[model samples]
Target: MTLELIDIAVQDSQSHPRLAGRVTGHVRAVLSEMLDGREQTHELSIPVWADIADGTSQSDIDLALMLKAAKIVARLKLSLQSPP
Candidate 1:
C-alpha cells in the first residue's frame, strides 16, 4: 500500500545526551505509529541528537547514572549546614 509522506526529520547540532535521547525516542515512536504497515519509496533520514554516544556503533546510554548523580547532589544540598 502506498502512503503519503508528511513531516521531515530534523537533527539538533547541540549534544545533550539525556535530553537528546528522550527527544529521539519521542520522534521514533511517532514515526513508527504514523507509518505502520505503509510502503514508502525513497530514503528517509531522521536527524537524531546522539552526542559522542554515537561514537559507538550501538548507542546505549544509562539514564539511571544521571539520576543517581542528581540524587547525590540533591542530598548534599539538603544536608544541614551552618547558617550563614
Candidate 2:
C-alpha cells in the first residue's frame, strides 16, 4: 500500500516491559536490515510518503530512502578519515 494509505498509528505502551521490549527488538531488526549493518549509531528524522491512486501524491518515501543511503555513505566516509 502507498505510504499515504499506510497510516502509522503510534500505540501507547500498556506499562508492559516484556511487550515493549519485544516490539523494540522487532523494529530494530527491520531497521537494521535497511541500514546494511547490525548496528547503526546514526540518527535520521525523515517524513516519507508515496503516491497513491488518488489525484494527489507524495514523494517523501523516495526522499527518505535516499536520505538513508546518504547517511550510510556519509558515516562510512567519516570512518575512513585520518585522525586530526
Candidate 3:
C-alpha cells in the first residue's frame, strides 16, 4: 500500500524544529502498519487538525496522532464502501 501526506497542520503543540519531521514519521509509520498486506494506493487530501497540550510527551502525541489518523482512514474507507 502507498500513502501520501500532502500537508499537516498542528496546533498547540511543542515548538521543536524537528516536530514536523517527527509528525511525518509517525504518520508514515501508522499508515504503513495499517495498510500492511494491502496492495492499494491511497492519496488523501483532507484537512486534519489537532490541538495537543504543550506538556504532552512525544510518545503520547505520537500515539494520539496515530490513533486519530487511523480512525480517519477507516472512516474514509467505510464511506467509500457505502452505497448512495
Best by TM-score: 3
The pairs that clash in candidate 2 are 49-61
lDDT of 3: 0.48
TM-score of candidate 3 to 2 decimals: 0.44
- What is the TM-score of each predicted model, taking all chains together? 0.24, 0.32, 0.44
Q: On residues 1-84, what C-alpha lDDT tens digit does candidate 1 reach at each position?
A: 223333332322334555533323111111121245764444333334333344433224323233333344335435633356
Report the number of the highest-lDDT candidate: 3
Candidate 2, residue 26: the lDDT equals 8
Better of 2 and 3 by TM-score: 3
Model 1, C-alpha of 57: deviation from truth (Å):
12
lDDT on C-alpha atoms for all candidate structures = 0.34, 0.31, 0.48
Off by over 4 Å in 1: 1-61, 80-84
Candidates 1 and 3 compared by TM-score, better number: 3
Ranking by TM-score, best first?
Answer: 3, 2, 1
Model 2 spans with C-alpha error above 4 angstroms? 1-58
TM-score comparison, 1 vs 2, better candidate: 2
Lowest lDDT 10-residue stretch of candidate 1:
25-34
How many Å off is the CA of 83 in candidate 2?
0.8
